[model samples]
Target: MKPTLKPLAEQVIVITGASSGIGLATACAAAEAGARVLLIAREDKDLRPIVAEIVASGGTADAFAADVGDAARLRAAAAHAVQRFGRIDTWINGAGVAIYAALRETPAEEHEQLFRTNYFGTVHGCLAAIPHLERGGALITIGSIAGDMPSPLMGAYAASKHAIKAYVEALRMELGEAGLPISVTLVKPSGIDTPIAQHAANHEPGEAQIPPPVYDPKLVAQAILHCATHVKREITVGGAGRAQALFAAHFPALFEVLAPKAAASFIDPARPQPRPDNLFASVRTGRIRSGEHHARRTSFYTTAAEYPGTTAVIGVGLAAGLGALIASRHRTRH
Candidate 1:
């Protein structure tokens, strides 16, 4: 049986990594929509003010402090959510960390920690949320375009996302075969303007910056909320990301040849030196968007992907327009 997910106002959501970035953006948006939100993160200090702000705005929100890397602590947070809010209708595994360094340069311990938080954290969340969601609900995990297309410098981070994509897909199949009422979705976003770059453990000579054509964190939040109500298998937020994935898949040799040229853009020596990173632990939190670059406010491809019939019509229109332009040019030349 397919799961009948509840509307935003009727649902209770637990968001890990809710202190910053996509997670924080989602939490705030969910609360604004009248969902009971449980904000989980390593820092209770950062969460407290955000929760208070949400409460002050007439939203139901509570803060839970825990590292998603710790299964015991994560499970405890899940229990607390159940205790605070009768039931969980949606559980978003958004907790993740990044390392801006080559695999060779990164220490063995850093790579392990990245996997523990990014990959295993999702595993723990899925296990912990399944029991509560048996009635019917959504399990959404934040993945990345890097999951589909491996990146340099951030190889470890990309690998973790790739693992997450695989794990989430497998879990979905297992649950579907068992006929459970659960909606499992993987949200793979492109370069989102979040604090991740700032928080990354940078080993390069300069500070880290998300590559250009960054989308606002709200775009990811929008996608997450949409998946909460609608049953979707996967959603990639940016068109540029989807395009790159396609290019990499279709022409791997060429992609490999050209991809390295963009690696230098990932670092910026002009930015302030020695920025604080959160590879080992949480540094600071509470902000959503990184103001480093101008972010695109909307994604046409993402919106079109959500509505297939519309995309089809748009595709046909583009084809007809191209045909007309070509014919007109040919006639003029003749």
Candidate 2:
């Protein structure tokens, strides 16, 4: 039998990387929805303020400081959550790091670090949370459009995301074959107004800037909350992100031609280069949303992603209409 997920209010949601970015946003949203939230990250200082803010807002929240890359530490964190909340209903693996540098310029250690935190951290979280997630639990991980379409300067980061995509799919199939009551979801977001650019290990000549058409991090948080209550295979955050992924999948040669130009356009020549690298350590003190790159506040793709069935139906209808138009045009020409 298939799984039926619990509502957000009744859930004990665990969010990794909850100190900032998408994870922090997700923690606040889950807490607001009345779920008991557990925030895990490497920095204890960072988690404390966020938890205090959540509690002050009349939300139930706790903090666990641990390196997501460490399997033992994640297992301990999971145990702590179960002890505190009674059970785990949803586990979100949102802990990850990015580096802005060409593959050749990137150090071997940097590539290893990215994979350890981004890919292996997710792997550890899943392994630790799976046994404890009593029936009807959800596993959600944050991936990137870069996974589908490799970014020029973010080769290592993209490769880690690609690895995440592979394993998440494999894990989904395994769960189905076993007939478990669990929902697995992967969220691929394009550029967001996250401090990732400022935090990333920049080996490039200039400072890093988020790719064009950035959306608010709350959009991503909304998507994550949706997955907690709904069953979905995957959801891309923005329309631009979805389009880039489709283009990468269907038109590889064309993507190769345009991807570099897109990357070049993303770089701001005015900003000074070589900022402090957060590759191995945390740089920011405590912040939720990174207002680094100002862009649109809403994303149509994010709103649509919550309703997959409606999106599919609309896609099919549009395709059919186009086909009818082509047929009529050919008939008229003949």
Candidate 3:
């Protein structure tokens, strides 16, 4: 059985890690589109203001404070969303943390905590959302390009994302075999211009920075919202990220030769001191975009991927036109 999702205006959406970054962006966008949104994060103090702002803008929204790592807390959050909004049409698992260090350099406790939030958090979100969405709905989890490619300094973080990808894929298969009406999607984004780097635990020489070719967080939010209504199996937000993954997959030796230098570039030597991070706890900032890096607003590759049929027709037309132009030039030369 395939899930039939409702339009954004008529749906109730629950977003974990909603206090900031991609989660906050998605919640605000959903509410603006008229979905009843329940925002979940670890800090009520951080969530309340965003809720108030959304409410002031005449969007239906509420705040729920809970750690995604805690299963009971996630269950409670799900119950609260149902109690407040009646039914959940979509659930987005976007809560995650990062660590910037070699795997050997990272503490065992930190590695465990990172997995608890990044991996188990998605698990908890899926378990909590399935009951509400069995009738029909979307289950979206925010993954990263690192989930597919190797990340050097962020080994633990990459490992967590890889685990998430595996788990989400297995869960999708199990749910499909069970004949449940649910659309499960994993959204893999490249280095997005969010506060993730600022919130990441840094064990390196300087502050952690999202590698180059950073994309806007709003693009990720747009993808998430689109999946709320569309039944996409997986969506990679940035084309460059997709290309990197493909290159790594096809040319493992070359990628391995260049990966360490590429990874070391993530550390900014200009910033000698490490910044405050949210590895163990929540940072109280609600700003969406990280102002440190300039992010591209549009991604033609993403647009083409999202609407492949249209792009395919356009590509054919362009190819034919170019061929005619080249033939004309050859005739003139002759």
Q: What are the lDDT scores of the predictions, listed in order? A: 0.93, 0.87, 0.93
Q: Name the weakest run of 10 consecutive residues (lDDT summed) in model 2.
A: 285-294
**Residue-wise C-alpha lDDT for candidate 3, range 22-61, written one tens digit per residue:** 9999999999999999999999999999999999999999
Q: Please write out the lDDT profile of model 1 over residues 1-334, one tens digit for every residue.
A: 8999989999999999999999999999999999999999998998999999999999999998898988989889889999999989999999999998888899999999999999999999999899999989999999999999878888999999999999999999999999999999999999999999988888888889897779989999999999999999999999999999999999999989888788789999877634667877787788898868799989998998687788999899999999999999999999
- For each candidate, what TM-score against the reference? 0.94, 0.91, 0.96
The stretch of ten residues in a row with the least summed lDDT in candidate 3 is 268-277
Q: TM-score rank, highest first?
A: 3, 1, 2
Model 1 clash tally?
Answer: 0
lDDT, candidate 2, 102-210, per-residue tens: 8999999989999999999999999998898637789999999888878898888999999999999999999888888888899998888777777788877677888
Off by over 4 Å in 3: 272-275, 324-334
- Let me know the TM-score candidate 1 reaches against the reference structure: 0.94
